[model samples]
Target chain A: MDRIQQIYNDEKLLKKLQEDQNLTIEDVLENEMVINMGPQHPATHGVLRLVLRLDGETVVGIVPELGYLHRGYEKMAENMSHIEFIPHTDRLDYTGTMCNNVGYVLAVEKLAGIEAPKRAQYIRMIVSELSRIAAHMVAIGTFAMDVGAVTMVMWTFREREKVNSIFDRIAGARFTTSYTRIGGVASDIDDQAFAEIKQFLAELEPALVEMDKLLLSNRIFIQRLEGIGILPKEDAIALGVTGPNLRASGVEYDVRRAKPYLFYNEIDFKIPTFSQGDCLARYFQRGDEVRESIKILYQCLDKIPQGEVIANNPKKVLSHKTEIYSKMEELIHDFMIINFGINPPIGDTYLSVENPKGELGFYIVSNGSGQPWKLKIHSPSFCNLQAVSQLCKGAMVSDVVAIIGSLDPVMGEADK
Target chain B: MNTKELIVEKIKEKFGESVEEVSDFRDDLCITIKKDQIVNLGKYLKEDPDLQFIMCKDVTAIDWATRKKRFTTVYHIYSFKLNYALRLKSNIDDNPPTIETVSFVWQSANWYERETWDMYGIKFINHPDLRRMYMPEGFEYHPLRKDFPVLGIPGSLPLPFKAE
Candidate 1:
């Protein structure tokens, strides 16, 4: 009590505190504090823990601790057959299961030297693009909610549910839709599902316009996000940041344009890029990407040719269920495939897809066997999360959530 | 010459003997070079005006359990300038395999190298802060190693302490 009274009575010390209202971080280093942000915190979006060292309210250093949800997917892939791994890919990025399905199947097809039929390729493109739109919706919605705009989540999720219903109609499962196969898709889309997709696309644009009016131009939202967490272009590329985050930092590279897997080369769309490299820029980039994905989806729907959905490679690709039950040849083939997996040739190939999060890749090494010798998943979230420490340093503690939301990391893929 | 031939020729010209194997599979270039030349090659690939392999996409290892060289460390580096990705592999013959770290070259490699070390039990020389990525600090076994079982060894992973 005496010490407190003395300090309170000390005019010089009190004067110094009052005058130096804008104290630099170095001035408060003597009272350095350490805080653990999460392994269970909601702002992290999943099981990600960040150990932050703080000098007053300024974050001096941050170390991200991960792998709370690691199920050893790589080890599991080695044990299972290539065909058996499709369902597992759905769990990698739960928000964009179709994209993960497409990525894994394409990798397997590339490794086995199997070409997907033209119709199947078009189907793959449509579903993956729709999945991309769904993922960006989640990203933008949660991002706005994180920054204190609550209504945007409702608007974004409404559109997402429409996309989910479309998925349910075509893929049978709304969430974990293992819709793609090694040489083709699981099933074909019917006329009703196609009509539903067309209607959803028409509704999405007006809803986006409403969302833009509500959140994008609002003064408080812009002020909260505009210049927060700026990741420069050079640093973004050097740190392996990809997808919307890299594009927001002014990198024009996209896996669809760069590699041209499937019929993406034939499709016309723009890769949205912004030079600001801030939280607002990242948010705007997602909005632009959703628009581009919509464009691609419309083109796919228009140009889709009517043909066989699954490729005719019975040796590598699985036969339809009806054929397996009715035809003797398909039954024998199904039996053989179920017991012994499709054996890819002895070689290694790495195939990446432009997943909404980033470059989701499968590096498969086949030793002329049903099971892969080694499988490495090059997940983009794992790479993007690495740059968090660099971004958060010297920034206010409150902006950490904003930075994480802008990155839009799915912990399933990161922890996988 | 095409991009593939040009890249091979440039790499071979710079380091002749170090370039051990160069092959094309699925239109991708896979180069196996001596472990000693990895850092040098990485620097050259990134710094050269023509080949700006600025992005390090992945760093992983293939565990060949019974081979003479127990592990093969692989790197997939990309050059936006060339619009190509090149795969580089180097063999580590030691038990508890030890190899040079390229995290210094690519900032993104820091976490990837940590992950590689955690999964394969491969020691990366000169790594900044080497620690297990997924498992706890006291966990003994490397889960991704070939000898490690799918279901995991019984009594290996420690369970949480329960109150009486």
Candidate 2:
């Protein structure tokens, strides 16, 4: 039977009834007391609330409340065409938006049934890895600050500035570089960008190595994380956890390895896993992943392929320039492409990509129309969030911050 | 067992007249069963060893605004054993929409079902906790429905104030 116990219209009335109806009887039976952690807390990388039922600091139950940052993304996508949705993807994971942009566009490309050119795929891999590194830096650095290490945040920001400058050189935006277009990319890699990437890679290496030295083996950092918030591998998978959190639990099922998307099949790297599903395992997993990302960047630099960046589908789409200028014939075609979006011949498609968090999937159904008939994003943050309730069942109240930091959920994608 | 063949073969083998599998499932599979048999199908999918479609990935209402009786609750599920996926669609009425819950099968459906109710107003007959997830409690209206104007609340039929 579908248990429809709570109703929105009657929540207060129900709670009020529960308060007075069985208060003498229920309270005599040792009922659990609810405590609200936050809709705004320092440890939750974004705005997240956890309703905990505690028996004197030992968590009896957990209810994760979300949607503080719901920007109406799915509804917003319905109003705009496919191409117009590029900017919206940037808001999913504001920390590492490049990966989010590629994740959405990849789904669009799958529905349209076309592949991005070799050069564009390689460039996407480069930019996405750079974004991955930047995201990990913020996650770990800020997580360190949450536990009382203020020094790591400054170091990470300094390193992140160097990385951001490279993105600024390419797309002229540091924070939200919507560089990924559907077919290929928004633009090409110019001589200036090529030099900046080479230079940044050199400067970024020692910073990561330095971070490893500073944080990983430190007694205080390890004490806060090592045995805190442990989740069993079986429990994590059963809870629908994905991305690094699952890998840190020793799953070893990276989507990059399981289902290689975006030139990932050609690239070589190790998928790191640790048997300990504690906060420290998650912390070091990101560290190992950052090292792996650096390895990917180095490989792409030496053997970058050469070809036209965007797809060669003349009827479907073209570069941004051809759409803006040129003859009226070109203009009409461009207008249809932008206005109508790619009219994917009536079919359903599900495409997922490995983000900094986990498997961020976009399940889309098209009706041979301009807009999507159905769109359901399987946000990894939303799925991984289930483990939190299970993981914190017996932990102290203060450890909730460490548990949240370990999961690293992005509310943009969660509430979207 | 191959998910496509098991779903088709098992349904016909067990309940001959009630099931049929659609072609082109290399990407994902879909099966059509009468709405009345939804509970049976839900139980079978949950219990069967080879086809343990245990996790209910998501549940959302698709509004074909221009079409008649325009409503459907799409169920996405994943089976770790089959290493496969399936989309089960159950039809709902345009007004007073409702569907059977698979919450008993997937405990994770508690909040997901509530969110679907809070968004599209598709009532899950026996959901354990059916309340607004993203939106505030005691608010009357499903925000995700197409007819619920981009900025209007359903009950009051007035502009949805941004701050409130």
Candidate 3:
């Protein structure tokens, strides 16, 4: 011991003394057995690999191995323009592209001190809620499937498609709708786009009711879930759990209410919470949240102020093929904005919106150049992944899947 | 108290020269402290009833290449009630930048500090569970450093595949 102490230092020796004297790093070993929960594991929800140290049924420890799908997205952002970066954000949370787009654009706006037009904010609110519904659909759908309810996934997506169709009408694409611009939306919402969204909402309520009937009261589903994967309120705060997980733990902290941004302040919606922080509580909390999201979407549509989607800045105009063909000046503006995206002032902003998962914030640092010095995506799934290790302890290996599924982690964002 | 000067005044009144909460540590409302004083500052921030900055939102580093102080460790603290943020930065060396872990203040930082350590090589001396967060198995060289390459020779500075 004296010889060992002599080599390191007094501080090292004291630390060694204070630690569980009999224990070593080697003693905290991954020995018993290996259970590789896959890059293709259905419970994982994406290309997520969790290597668990198992003693037969119980997981002794878990080693979360990511980057099977590292797009090198952070490094890629260094080269892309601010506008060009929107589509990439869509891919981050493949479940909810609109929130990703709004969060990112709002961040760029904060640095530039540009405000989205009232109409634009209203439109953004509509699309973001639609995306939230879509995200919750995927979360609840896959979660139900993970715990063995086959039909709900199909029911949720069937309605989700109607929402996607509305998005397709507005932004010319369903999934990666790079809809929100720095100052406003890419363009104004037409009568047709508004009609389609209204139609979708009308149809959406019944689908949600059907989903509740299908999952909420199902005996086996409730049995499998209920008290499983419980995260208490105080522990949830200590672990920095946010979004639905925080709400599930009964904290009632929503970023939209906590720190208002864009049209969130104007819009009225309830923040749903559950006293029980179980997997079932999280599942039901999201179900109720989808109802609240529908309410918000209805409010936005009812009160969407009459105005242009993009602000009056001529420079802000996007080059649509139709516009380019019709007007000579439009051609030049389109190419310039397309080739070189909006250049915000050299500053930084951490603009977060209540994304589908939770607090989806973008921390963008601009160095007086068009390119961002650093683009730190404070993704909700990435933050929530920290809770898995704690949640999985002393539980059966099968329970790990339920716990992970309840969290509803998207590996794309987690790995990003 | 204005959000800008609340932390500065509190730290100045308490620790005096032990810390400097300046508006422009890197041209923001930055609170600069000596490496040794981090634990005390963290504890004070936690127990002090007025500033319930109980949450350590993130722990990261900024590389000022070849400056007198090479790297700065920035700790972001968030209080839901105050609805404001404070950036506490500390200057640490390039060689395995080590600071005492704030696991005592916030348990969330356990994984966060490890992630920072894995990405930027900033060692949290008292981190109870200091293991890799993102990189692959047996990886060496912090990937997030200004100079560290995205690609490193596999198995170069490899620690064993630890499951903690």
Candidate 4:
């Protein structure tokens, strides 16, 4: 007790405390408590830890701690071959692996001066849009669930599962489908797979309507979300927020429209924009985006060319399995590709796609090697996560969950 | 002149000697400039009427292990108004490589700079929060450095799961 009193009374100790915390003695005595929200909280949606400084249920400051799921993806890319790293990208944005895979392959293809055929481009577009719908379903479903609407998850997931079944038919895997290859896709979509996609598209409009009826019209949901977590247009651009979040802030900067890639220029779609820039606006943008994706998918189905899926360059792209198995020369080519990997010219390329979240980019620096000299992922979630501190200022604690859900961050990509 | 050429010419006109090298790769204009002039370049790019590169898309660094200037920090800036993309590169030579912070120009550079520092050990001078981003604080080495082993440093605990 005497020691404690002596330390408290000491001038040096008091001065040190004041310097470190920038707090006056009076401020220290006042009841300002610091609390940790989660590295495990369900509201965070993933392994995100928010250190919130609170003064009676109002957030004074927030420090977001990240990297709970860092798997050294960039470092791993440096070590592995270009083809080997495709699966790793799937793990980055696990929910929207198709976009991640396409982004990576597109960058690699650019580096190697190769382009996927017209049919392959359309197929990539279709799968990417399908993945976008699946991802948005999870985003909206989980968002609704976070705001205390439990049935939204069940409704959205049912639709998501239907999409997953289509993915299962096209690619062997349902979740982390590494269907995209560097110069093309692994296999062409069959008639049955196409029919399944058409079926899914038929049912999607009604599902979206059901979702709108369930959550968008809910008065309590709107009351909680509307006019909350407003990110102004200039601030959104300054902070580098993209995709629907930036669109909600009235920035018409969808990568698909701004910089067309993979037959997006040929297809027609609308970039949804909302001037509100609040949680409700962000939610509305996602709903609108799912509709736009449906339009693109339909266009892709109608306009897709009937031709080769993979590029004809045998030196760059691997041959088909039938050719590799039957012909000795083709078998040797396969062996060489698998053993040494496809080496791109010594250069760097940056390619991004309009992911369900935002502009997911891959910046690859190739030194005329099988493996990349350096690979950097410009993850949308990581950039969007940075705005939380700016958005949460002076807001009630409950708004944090809505704001985070609206951002729709996946920790895997953010941490990487 | 095309947008790329105009950008190159404008940059050359603005800062003659400061612009080290300009290259065009796959239609993207890349300009390597003096490290000290990056912040000024960023401001010019953002505020320039013709070249309104308001959005700093990404900021990252590459470790050229064999080079005298061991690190090159790359910035990808996009102009929605002008409809062009620019790549800015600056080489750093400090033992712990240091470059000027562009967070003031674009608020998004804050986290990007932090991640660069965390991964490559490049310090951003005048950065408000120049701390480890993805990596934990007090971590000994930058994992993304060329010298770091791919299998990871020896004597560390083996990964729990084995490859099937």
Isolated chain A TM-score, each model = 0.93, 0.90, 0.87, 0.93
State TM-scores per candidate.
Answer: 0.95, 0.87, 0.86, 0.94
Instruction: Please identify which of the two predictions, 2 or 3, would achieve the higher DockQ against the true structure.
Output: 2
* Residue range B66-142, candidate 4, lDDT tens digits: 99999999999999887777899999988878888999999999999999998888989999999898777767778
Best by DockQ: 1
Every candidate's DockQ is 0.87, 0.35, 0.28, 0.77
lDDT (Cα, tens digit) per residue for candidate 1, span A1-416: 99878867999888887788688866666788999998998899899999999988899999999999999999999999998999999999999999999999999999999998899999999999999999999999999998899899998999999999999999999999999988999899999999999999999999889999999678988998989999999999899998999999999989999999999999999999999999999999999999999999999999999999998877888999988899999888888777788998889999999999999989999988899999999998898899899999999898999999999999999999
> lDDT of each structure?
0.93, 0.79, 0.79, 0.91
Sort the candidates on TM-score, descending order.
1, 4, 2, 3
Ranking by lDDT: 1, 4, 2, 3
Query: Residue A90 CA error for candidate 2 (Å)?
Result: 0.5
Task: Judging by lDDT, tell me the better candidate of 3 and 4.
Answer: 4
Task: Please report how far candidate 3 places residue A119 from its true position, in Å.
Answer: 1.1
Ranking by DockQ: 1, 4, 2, 3
Shift of residue B78 alpha carbon in model 2, Å: 3.0
Write model 3 residue lDDT over A37-127, tens digit each, in one string: 8988778888888889887688878877666676656656766788778789888999899889899888877776667678888888888
Distance (Å) between predicted and true CA of A35, model 1?
0.4
Q: Which pairs clash inside model 3? A: none
Error of 1 at A80 (Å): 0.6
Question: Between the candidate structures 1 and 4, which one is better when assessed by DockQ?
Answer: 1
**lDDT per residue as tens, model 2, A335-377:** 7887777788787777788999888888787888878866777
- Best model per TM-score: 1
